[model samples]
Target: MVSERAAQVLVASNRGPVTYAFREDGTLDARRGGGGLVSGLSAIGTDADALWVCAALGDGDREAVRRGVAEPGVRMLDIDATVHADAYNGIANSVLWFVHHMLYQTPLEPVFDAQFRRQWDAYRTYNRAFADALAAESAPGAVVMIQDYHLALAPGMLRELRPDLRIGHFSHTPWAPPEYFRMLPDDVAEELVRGMLGADRLGFLTWRWASAFMQCAGNVAEDGRIVSSAPDDPRPRIRHSPTGESAFRTTLVGVHGLGAEAGFLRRRSHELDVEERMVALRDQVGGEGDRKTIVRVDRTELSKNIVRGLLAFRTLLDERPEWRERVVHVAFAYPSRQDLPVYRDYTAEVARLSEEINAQYGTPGWTPVVLHVKDDFARSLAAYRIADVALVNPIRDGMNLVAKEIPVVSDAGCALVLSREAGAYEELGDEAIVVNPYDVTGTAAALHQALTMPDGERAERTKRLAAAATALPPQQWFLEQLHALEALGEGGEEADDLGRT
Candidate 1:
C-alpha cells in the first residue's frame, strides 16, 4: 500500500514521541507524549519511513531501554544518569533556556565556574550520544530533523560522522540576540552557532527569531558577514564560515509559525468530561451571577509572566473599582520543570501573588482570583469554552500556542489580549488587543478593553483570529519543512561540495 523510499527521515530530540511507565508487576505501559514536536510528528503518520531517536528521561524509560522495548517508530538512548542531569538540568534548561528567555538576573546569577565547564563537557557527551544513535540507525542519505536547543551540537556532530546525510535543525525557543548570546563562554557561544550551521536547513518559529540567529552567526562567523538573498525573502540561503579555516556552507533559514490542530481541539472540547469540567468552571467563575471570565492557561515557567498578569488584574481592581465583582480571573497555572529550584520558587511566588490578589479583593459571594496549579487538559479546554477574555502575556515565547488555541475552542467568541513578544503576534496582532508584556498599567487597560468589547466586534475579531491561528496546521507545518528539505537535497549541489572541499 506504500511506496518504498531510499532516504528515511530521522528525528532527534531530548524527548521522544511516547514515554513508558512500569507497573509493579514489571509490565510497561506506553503513553503518547505531549508537546508541539510530538504533535507535529503525528501529522506525518507512523509509516513515513521515519525513525525517532530520543533520550530516556525517567526510570521507566531507562528500564524500557534496558529491555530493548522501544515503541514502534522510536529509539530511546539511555545515557549515564549523572551525565544526563548535568547536560539537561545544567546546560540546556539552566543555561540555554535562561539565555534565550532572557531570564538571568545578570550580576547576581549565571556564574559559569569550573563546575559549569564540567557540565559543559557532559552536555557535549550527551549530544554525542544522540549523534551516535542517529548515525547508527539512519538509512544511507537519510534526512535528519533535529529539534530545539537541547540538541544544538548534535547536527554538527552528526555531520562530521556522516557527511552524506541531509540535516535540518528547528529552534522551538526564541533565539537570543547577539548581545545576550555572547554572554556564553567565547568558545561555547561560537560552537553553538557553528554546530547549528552544520545543518542544511535551519528553521525558526518567527522572522524576528530568524533575524536574531543571523545576527549571532554574523558576529561569530569568520568574515563577520553572512550573505543572504533578499531582505524580504521568506526562505533565504545564507552562507557562513564557522572559522577562518572552515569552508562556507549555504544554509537555508526560514520561519514556520506552528499552529494548532483545529479539528482535534474542536472534537476534544465537546467530550463529556470536558463538558462536565466546563460546568464546574462556569460555577467557579459565575458563582450566583454571570460574571465575565478572564482566563489564562500557562505552565509555571518564569518567562510566562504569570506574576505580572496577576498584578495587572490587581491594578484593574484598583483603577476601576466599579468592575470588582463583575469579572473573575480564572488562571490555570500548571506545574512545569519542578526539578529546577528556580522554577519551584517562581511557582511559589505565583501562588503567593494569587492569594494576595484574592485577599485584597474578596466579597462574601465572589472570589476575584481562582487559581489552579495542576495539569488538566480537559479543565483548560473547559476554561477556553467559557472565557470572555483570554490573556496570553508571555514575556518571550517561541509560538505560544495557547494564544492561538483559545480562539479556536471558545464557545461564544473570545477576545484575545496578546503580548507583542509572543510569536503569535506576528500573525494575530491585527485582531487581538496587543500589549507590552512589561507594562502592568497597559496590560490592565487592555484587559479592561477586552472585557468591555462589544459582542459583535469580539465575534468578528475572534473569527479572523481563529482563521489566522489555524492557517498552518501542525500537520501542514511539519510536512512543509520536510518538503523543503527534500527539495533542497534534490536541487542543490552535492552535500560534500557545499560545506567543505
Candidate 2:
C-alpha cells in the first residue's frame, strides 16, 4: 500500500471536479468539471494544500480509481455500486430530496419500512466511507468542507474521528420546514440533525433555507440532545451535551446566496457556438424577429413544475387568441435523474404536453412551441440571449440560477415572470413579476403583462435584475463562507460574511 499526503484544506462532495469516461478500448477519458466550486477552489491558489474527496459514480470512475488515476489534489473512492445506488438514488434522491422539496404525495408515499431501514444502513456505510477518507487525508487542525444531503452524516462521523479539525457543511437545497421534517422517523430525524450539527459552521443558499435548518436542528425529536438559541437570533447554535464532561458544541450558521459569475457569462454568451445557436433559434421562433418569444430552460425535475408552466402557456393562448402566431414559447426541458421512475414519467409528460400545445395552436407558417429535450449549454445561452420574456416558476427551489442567468445574458431585455417560492425571489423579487407557482391563471396573466410591457421599462428592469443577481459572484460567495469558517478559529467575530450584502 502507498502512503498518502496530508492536506490542510479539503472539500468533500457526491461528485468531484473531474469525471472519467470508459473508452471502447481500455483507456479512460478524463474530463474536468466547471462551475462555482472549480472556480472558487482555483482562487485559493495551488499552494494551499487543498484536496477534494468524492465517490466513484460509475463503471468508468471505478476503473479510473482502480488504476489510481493521478489527477492532482483528487481522491476517488471506489465504493461498491450497490451501496452507491442505495445511498444516492434510494435515500439521498428519494427520501431527503422529497422531504426538502416537499414533493411527497403524503397519502400513498414515504412508508419507511424494513427495506428503508436496510437502505438507511447503506447510507450510513456510504457516509462512513467518505468520513474515513477525509479523516485519513486531513492534517491536524485542518478544515474539511462537506457538500449536500448525500453526505449529511459524514460530518458527525468525521468529528468523532478527528475532533480537532474545523468542519463546515453547505446545503444546496431548501431545507424542509419543521412540520414536514417531522414526517421522518423520530430517531432518523434526530440522527440527521445531530450529524449536521457536528459541523463547526453551516451554510445555505438563502436565509429562508438556513432558518429552516436552524428550526429543525433545534426541534429534532430526541431527549433534548440538540437545543438552539432563540429564533430571533441572527446566528444560532445547536447545543449538545448538557453535562460539562465533553462540554457543548455550538454550530454557527450563515447564508451565502450563490450568484452568477458575470464576467465569464458575458464572455461565453457571445462565443461562436452560442452565436450559431442563437441564429438557429431565432429562425425557429420567427425569421427577422417578427414574433415575441417566451423562454424557459430547466431540467425535468418534478420540483421545477414544468408541467404547470406548459399548462399556463396553453392557458395564455386560450385566453388571448390574438397572440397565437404572434409569439413562440421556447422550452428546453433537459433530462435529469432518468434512472428514477418518477423523473422518466415527468420527462414523458413534458414531451406530451408540448406536442399537445403544438397540435392545438400551431399553424403551417408558425410553431407555437419549440421543445428541445436534450441539454446543450450553447443552446441554453442562445435561448437566453433571444428571450423576450423568461418564465421561471418552480414549486420550490434552492436558487433557480436560470432566473438570474437570463437577465445577465439577454441581448434584448427580458422580463422575468418568477415564482415567489424560489430562493431567487428573495433577491430579485423587486424587479420580477412574481406569481404563485400553483396559480396557472395568475401566471398566464403575468405572462401577458410581461409580453406587453413597454420596451423601455423591460430594458430597465433587466438591468436592475442583472445587477442584483450578480451582487455576489461565485468566487466571492465561496470565499465569504471560507472566511466566516476561518474566522471561527481565529477567536474573531463569527459569521463575518453574514449581513455584508
Candidate closest to the true structure, highest TM-score = 2
TM-score of model number 1: 0.95
What lDDT does the true structure give each of the candidates?
0.87, 0.89
Backbone clashes, candidate 1:
0
The 10-residue segment with the lowest total lDDT in model 2: 492-501
Model 2: clashing residue pairs?
none
Instruction: Note the clash tally of each candidate.
Output: 0, 0
Deviating ranges (above 4 Å) for candidate 2? 1-4, 242-246, 490-501
Q: Which candidate's lDDT is highest?
A: 2
What are the TM-scores, per candidate, against the unseen true structure? 0.95, 0.96
Query: Residue-wise lDDT of candidate 1 within 137-213, one digit each (tens)?
Result: 77776778999999999988988787777889999999999899999988899889888887888999998999888
Q: Tens digits of per-residue lDDT for model 2 on 204-311? A: 998899889888977774555566666567666656653223455678877888888888999999999999999899889974688999999999999999999999
- RMSD to the native, candidate 1? 3.0
